[model samples]
Target: MSSARNSYDVVVVGGGHNGLVAAAYLAGAGLSTLVLERLARPGGADLVSPLPGAVVTDLGLDLPRGSRNPACGDLASDLVRAVGPTLLQPLPLERDVRAQVDPDTWRDFVSTPLGVTLEARYADDAERGRVAAEALTGTFASLHDESLAANRGLLYRLLGGTASTRGVAELLTQAAAGAGAELVTSAGVSSIRGGDDGAEVSWHDGMSQHTVGARFVLSNVAPWVLQILMGGDEDPATKPEGAQLRIDLHLDRLPRLRSGADPEAAFAAGIVVGSGYAELASAYDEAAAGRMPSVLPGRLQGRGDTLTYLGTHTPARLFADDPQGAKDLAVARALATIDTQLAEPIADRVVHLEARTPQDIEHDLAMPGGHRFHGDLEWPWAPNRARLDTPAQQWGVQTDVGSVLVCGSGSRRGGGISGLGGHSAAHAVLASR
Candidate 1:
C-alpha cells in the first residue's frame, strides 16, 4: 500500500506512447503510478500502430487493427514469436530463435547483404528501387554491408504493420488517467537514485525541482541518455545516430509523373528515385565520405495534397558545421530527384516545404542523434545475445539498475510506434509482484 505523500508504486519517466501504456496497465492493476514527460504534450508527431491485441482487448480500447505489409507474410510473424506474451515472466533457458526458422532462409537473411536479395528478387529496376528504399530506411549502410542491418531494419518496419489513423498516446493517456495514474507534462527528470526498496526520482518543472520515491522506475529514454543522467561514463560510439531526412510538403495538388502512372497509386506506394541498387550504393558512399550524394536517394508519398519525402544516408554528423545550410541542400536535392520522374517540377506544386533534418529530430525528441530506434536497428535473433534470466530481462526491458527498466525504443521489441515495449515492462513488474 503506497500511501506516502511523495511516494508511488511506480514512476515512469518520459511520457511518450510506451510510458503511457505502462502507466495505464500499472494503474489499472491497482498500483499508484505517475508519469513524467519533458515535452508539453505526451505524444510525438507521428501516427502509431495498433496496441497489441491483448492490450486492446483488456483496455477495451476502440482502436482499429492496422493492416500489415503483405511482403513480410509469415516470416515476420515467426521472427516476432520469441518476444510474445511469454516475455511477461522470467525465462529459465535461452532458446536458439534462429533455429526455429528454416536453415536456408535464415542463412540467406542473416548472412547475405540486403542488396543481393533486392537484385535477385525483383527484376524491374523501379520496383527493386522501391523495395531497396525500405531496406535502407534509418540505416547508414549500403546493401553490401553484410551486417544485415538493412535487412533487420526492413523486417522491423514490416512487422509494425502500418500506422493507424488514431494516435496511441492519447488513448493511453485517457486509459491511464481513468485507472488513477497521475500524468504531468514539462516535468523533465534529472536524476534517478536507487536503494534496496526503490528509487528516488528528481525532476524539474522549469522553476522548481521535485523528488518522488517509487518502488520501481520505468525509463522511456535510450540507454545512453539514461547513462548520462545517472552520471555514468559517456561513450560517444554507443549514442544513437540518425542518417535520414524527412521533408513534409503541403502541396496544392499531386505532381504528375512522366511515366503516365496514376499519381495516386504511385505516390501511395512511394516514388523512389536513384538509378538502381548500384546508384543507391554510390549515394551511401558519397554521404559517408562527407558530401551529399550527386544522385539523392529519396521516396515521395502523396495523400490528400500533402507529400512527404524521406531521404536516407544523410547522417546528422553532416549538419554539425551548418545545420541550416545542409538541411536546405537536402530539401532541394530531394525535390530535384523527384523532378526526374515528374511531368512538371515538384517544387512548383509545393504550397510549403517543411524539412526535418536528423539534427532537427534529435532536438525535438531529445533522442541523442535523432535515430528513431534509439540506436542501430538490431535483428531479433542475434548471435548469442539472448538473455531471459530475470523478469525484466525476459521482457527485454532490463537496465543496469534492478528497479529501473527501459520501456522505450531501446527495449528488445521497441521501436516503430508499437506499445509492446511498455506492455512487456508492465507485465514484468506485475510478474515480479
Candidate 2:
C-alpha cells in the first residue's frame, strides 16, 4: 500500500458515467478537476468484458444509442456529434423473448416475443385503471378495475418507446478527454468536511490516506455513504429525503420462444408480465423475503449468446445505511421470476448469472437506492422538473455550487446513459466560473 496526497480544485467521487462527465467539463474549464474511483478501471457499473472473438460482453444493458426523453435525446445527439466517433456508435435496437409458466404446472410454458403479455384476470375497469395508474406513477399502489382500463393509452405510450444501450464509460471518457478532465481510478474517498472557507476531502487507497481541499463537494454516493465517509451516521448537509431501489439480472441461456419466433424481437419488446397491483405487491414481498417473485413482463436484448433481463422488482423500503439483504432478496426473486418465465430450463445455459442488488449497486457506484436513474420520474412528479436540474439539486454539469458543482445521475434529470447529468453539471460548472 502506498500513501500519497494530492491536491485539486475540484474532486468527484466514483467513476460512473456521471462522475466522468463532471470531471470532463471541470477539466475542460481548466479547473484542475480530479475524478476518484474505487474500481480497478474507471467505468464503474458500465464496465465491459473482453470476450473471445473481438467482442465485448456488457454486464449491464448494452450501451444506449438514443434517449427516451425527447429533450435529453436532442442534447445527447449534440454531445455525440461534438465528441465524434470514439465516444459511441449507432447500434440498432435489439429485442428479447419472454414466456410464462403456469404456476400450478411449471412445465407448461406460454412464451412470446412481445415483451408484455396480458391475461384476462382483471375483474373490472376499476382494476384495469389501477394497473394503469401504477404504471404511470412507477409506484406500488392499488387501483380500481375502472382505473386500470382508463389508463391503457398512457401505459402503451410509456412502454412503446424505443430503448437503447450504450457504453456509458466510453461516452464519458471521450467527453472527459475532449473536454480535458483528469480522471483518477482506485482512489476511495474517506471523508468530506465542509467549512465556511471551503470543503476538505479525505480519501484512501490500499496504502495511505490523502486529502484535498475544494471550494465545494457534491457527493455522488448515496446519501448514506456520504454520512459514512464523513465518519458519522448523520450529516445534515448530505442526507437525502427520498430514494428508490432497482435490480438488474444477467442470465446465461437465451429465453426460448415459440418456433420461428424472433427471440430478440420477443425479448426486446417490453411487456407487463405480471397481473394487477396484487401480483406486483406479492412479488415485491416475496423478493423481500429472499424468495423469487413471479415474473414481471420486461424487455430483453442480446449481443451474442448472452442475454440481459432488465425490469423492476417489487418495491420495498430502502434505508440508506443497510440494503444488502434487500438486494440479495431482490436478486433471488429476479432469478425465480426468470426460472418461472423462460420456456426451457436456463440453469445450465446460464454462463454468468449475477444480480446487482441495490446494496451492491451502492457499494459499486456509491449511489443511493442502487437506482441507476438520478431521480424518480413517476406521475404526480412534473415532467419538466423530472430532469436533472430540479430546485432541490442539479445532477448535470451545471447548477450553482460556487466553484463546486454536481454532475452525477442523481443531480437533475437523473439516470441512464443519456449524459444529461454530466452535460448539465458541466454547464453549471462553466457558468459558475
Candidate 3:
C-alpha cells in the first residue's frame, strides 16, 4: 500500500471507547473527525469471544451498574446514564469453595458444602461498640472488623457495581458511526507532532506508511505510551505508578460438593473470597521484598458454564522490573490461595486456564496500571483531585490540546467500562470548543 495523505478537522488515536466517544461528539458537531486504531477490531478490553451455545464471554471487565444505582452514586451517575443502560449481573459461588486455612483468620477460606452469599451487613450493637472501643486501643483486627461492619452499606454498594457485558469498544464503534466519524483499524500510530494549527500524524499499516494532518488530536493511549509518540518531557501525573495490571482465571467447571444424604441439594454458590485488608497488606510487603506472597485474595463469579477468579497483582517495581514475571507470580498466588480454600485438591479438574498481564492490558486495551478503575482511591490527593473535569498540569484532557480530548478511563475519573469518562470527555470538549 502507498502512503495516503488525508486531512481532517480532528484525529483521534487508540480507537478505545474514550477515543471513539470523543471522535463521535466532534464529528457530530460537523467537524471532520477520524478515528485510528492499531488493532483489527476496536473494542479494546471490552472485546468479546464466542463460546459454545451462543454465549458471548467478555474478555475485559464485567458489566457496570447504572448511574442511579447506589454503587455508582459516588462516581459519575448522570454521565453514565447519558451513555447507556447499566449492565449488572450476579456472581455466584458454590459450596466446598476454597478459603485460607488459618484458623484465626477468615482471609482465604472456602465455604463448606453449604453456599454463602457474601453481602455487606451491619454488625450487632454490641459488636459495633466493642469494635469502636478496640480502635482506641489501636488493635488492628478489631479496628478492621469494626470498620467493615460500620461500612457495610458502602461495601455493599461497591460489591454491586456494574460492568459492560457487551464491551465498551463495540458500543463506541456504533456511537462513532452514528455521529458520521470515519474509523480505520490496523493502523499503528508512529508519531504525533505540531501545534493547534494542525497535528501531523504518521502511522503505518502492513503495506505502507500513512500520514494525516488534523486541526485537533485526541490520544486515548496511556500517557506512558503517548510519550513514545510525542517524545518530550512527559507528564508524570497522567501516567500511573506501581502495579498497573490485573489477571483473571476462568475455570471450565464449577466445584461440586458430595452430599451423602441429600443428593439433590445445591453444593457451591458464588462469593467474593479475599484475604481482607490485613492479609493483603502482608502480601504486598512480601512482594515488595522480592519474595513470593503466601496468600492472595480474589473475587469469584459464576456465569453459566464457567467460574471466574479475578485477583490484583503485585506492583510493577517488584521482580526486578519483570512485569510478566510479576503477573505470573500474582496468578500463581491466586491459584494457590484458591487451592487452600477449597480444602480438597483440584489440580486435575482444571480444564482451562489463562493469564493476562499488565503489558498485555496496555498493548491490547490501552489501560494504564492494568487497573480496572481510572484512578486509585488510596492516595490522599486522589479523591477530589482526580475526576473527569479535573485535568493534570501539562498533558491532560484540558490544556490547549485542541478541540480533541480524552474520554477513556485514564482520565481523572479513572477506570471500569462505565463509559462515564467518554461521556464526560465529550461534554468537556464540546463546551470548550
| Residue 362 accuracy (lDDT) in model 3 | 49
Q: List the residue pairs that clash in candidate 1.
A: none
| Model 3 C-alpha lDDT per residue in residues 333-402, reported as the tens digit of each score | 7776766546444344466666665456545655554544433321101222333343221213443355
Q: Sort by lDDT, best first.
A: 1, 3, 2
Q: What is the lDDT of candidate 2?
A: 0.46
> Can you write out model 2's per-residue Cα lDDT over 334-368, one digit (the tens) per residue?
45555555666556567666654444555666555
How close to the true structure is residue 315 of candidate 1, measured as C-alpha lDDT? 88
| Candidate that would win on lDDT | 1
TM-score against truth, every candidate: 0.89, 0.61, 0.63
Clashes of 2: 61
What is the overall TM-score of model 1 with all chains considered together?
0.89
Please identify which of the two predictions, 1 or 3, would achieve the higher TM-score against the true structure: 1
Best by TM-score: 1
